[model samples]
Target: MQGEEQWFSRTPGVEARQKIELDMVNSLLTSVAFASDPSRQLALEIIAEQFEQPATIRTHPTPRAQLIEIVRTYARNPDGLRVLVDVVASFDPQSFGTVRLRQLFDEWQAAPSFTDDDWSAFRSALGDVVLPQLTELFHLATRNRRHRPPAHCKTAWHYFVHLTDLNAGADSVPPYMIFLERVAPLLPSSTGQELRMRNHRLASELGLITAVNEIHLHERESLPPQHHTAYLVIQLESDGIDPERYTLSHWYQWDADGWHPERGEDRTVSILEIENEVERLVFDMETNWVEAVETVTLEFILPWELINAPVDWWRKESHSSRPTPLTMDYPVVVRSLERLRTHRWHRAWHVRWQRLNTDPTSVLPYWSKPAGKNYHTLLETDLKSDLRYACLVLSEPPLPDSSGRTEIETALRAGLPVIIWHRRDCGSPDFREAVQQMLAGETLAQLPILARKLRGEALRLDLADRESHIGRHLTMLWDDPERQPEVSRSYGTPEEGIR
Candidate 1:
């Protein structure tokens, strides 16, 4: 009732209110149809400023639907208004935009102004059109190098924060962080790779970009050379479009990676050697997994801070040349991915994730290709009991995906042995799992996960050595547990790896 009274309070002069001609319901359509650019821009401008206000419980429901409809009616040709999101995201977070705009909205909402309901209605509509549109814009901004100038994330962040403030109830949090969460999990392996090229923050979080060779590998069969295999290409803001270059500024990425120093250059050169090892692995694996080589480390050095320190820096640092005097450990994903497409090994059946976002970190290092299948896509008919396949557990460090644990248990109940490739980077849950494996005894069903990285195995042994590495793993995996009581090739005793 109090809320209603406050809502009613907005009905300033009964005579004045009655005299107001435009109805809130059709204001947007009317405005878009008749208002000049000055007038229409005012509406957007005012709403943009109002977003600075702290949230409060609305006394009268703001004419949310009607106002949003107004925006849609006006923004009918969305392409012309593609900047609608960019505009909204442009507001200065410090204190809205102009005092003039904020006062206009504040005054109108307070009384019998012809636009009383329009302000709230307009704001409601702004969010409806803007939030989802941001996802699209963000995707473009992340991918298209041309968007660098205006769709700056800094501006977007400010606009997003204010927009959240204006739209939220007292308890609501800002939307960017939530949007980021959505972005991370939603990214596919392919999209993540593109984002990595741009050095987007989420790409780093996902480990898409690394600190090794600056060689880029997005060259698909149809695409021309967008990759920098030998040098980290540089692009200047003034350069625009196809990327501008002056001198061996192409090698500027080396300087940025601390390679301006001889020591840094030397270390980078050593990392290049690793890339060769990865190439060898790809060749061996594709020719035949049994005869293949594997990498103990596909190192990518992260230059996160140097890139973000300034736009000037980013302009100067586009691509880094591949390693010089390179040693072992550089990860060559391009070659690996191509080869993986033809490999004959089978992936896990009916995979389920425990977390909302899929972590490709574990997936990529574990498999030569990627764990492309997700559990959520499966149907009941797709699931069957007493299956003879192995279950691979990718227990996320913080928490597994919602259904991951349940699916693993189901496999166990069905008398299936879950085989996990283990290594030195055992996840947070490895201790508990080791305890479980120990208690279950030496049954194949209870074997501790097999991680190739156990005891830094990848680091010590070149995966290229077929008999000692791949052969040993293949023999252990294929050997019949019942017939062989204890598999001789179980290298370090699966029990030792649990630690």
Candidate 2:
């Protein structure tokens, strides 16, 4: 009656709340042992209620140990696990100190070493009752770990290696490898490869060989650039069954400091791994050459399809909102149409030449069949023959639907400046901020203007500092006549410009 009165009261002190909670926990344990279904549910409800109370209502050791045991034991039981998970999830490590919980977790993690039997028991308990909840608990633990940054000199790699070594039987490979792979490309080449090799060696040493394959670099590139004459074309590849079906990601360069990926530095060429029924993995590397003699086209072969075909098909339906048969309105198709429209005049006149030189029917698509006159005849006559400079234009948001952003980014990376006409309604505030930064030289605006400015300044400055500074080295090479052959060799075979 006293406990019932306190439970119904508007406010109860720490002592009363703790006594009630302890009694409820003991009752729940009794009910679980006796297999009393109704009492089990009632006990869960009582635990939930106690958890909802302020932290001040529960003291450190008692509540912490009780919750840890609940998580460690009943984590496999659907209802019981849910109750424990809810309590832990509700805790704010910042507001309510997580010190005790963390300590208990460390103990639980180390419990196996106390005795071989303890390890076996934990494994059995996890396999039977807690396996389903493992992912969620793992995420919770990871989040908590991230909240308080590890001490200086302690990298994530350190923690990962330590844990995997300590808990050799735990299936830590999938999640750990996934995180590493995601961040790998962003790391410096040397550092990235070192970490990867370390992971591979550790996995092998621990006999976790299944995870070793995941550490291998599936994508390979040709080589790095030499000088002003040539640029490196990195070919990336994956072991995926159908390579051509996957869209190639933009090639990124390490910035001036050799740390971060350069912003706005990309190539106009689109690389894809195409999988045809006949050809298992065909790399369709596409790029246009307007002026440069050579270009580096990176071919990436992934072990997995970067774009899942079914997901892509669903995405097409959702984005275009066209019926299945009418889904030809997708971005890729739309882009081809836009390019056709822009090149109508060139195409029509070229048809006359192509008829004599090769093919004429290809030009017919631009003309409206019903109308006698060609739709793009006027555009053809206005075309200039000796136009030396091409403008890379950025007029709208680089939405996936518009490949313009990719095109513009590629041009800038190739050291071309772009002309951007600001369209206020087409982009968000963040995009506008990016544009402002590009103009001010604070950030690499991925605009051609920045490239032009940097190149122009480099040409005017004295380059006596070549050996010491990388910028000077690039500048010296830009001026060097001897390096022409080397630079030229790095540039891949030039192709026609993308319209």
- Residue-level error in angstroms, candidate 1, position 326: 16
Query: Which sections of candidate 2 miss by over 4 Å?
Result: 1-69, 72-74, 77-90, 95-97, 106-162, 165-392, 395-421, 425-499
Best by lDDT: 2
Q: How far in Å is the alpha carbon of 35 misplaced in model 1?
A: 28
TM-score of each: 0.21, 0.23
- Global Cα lDDT for candidate 1: 0.27
lDDT string, candidate 2, 249-283, tens digits: 22222122222221111222223323221011111
Model 2 clash tally, residue pairs:
30
Q: All candidates' lDDT scores?
A: 0.27, 0.30
The window of 10 residues in a row where model 1 has the poorest summed lDDT is 331-340
lDDT accuracy of residue 380 in candidate 1:
18
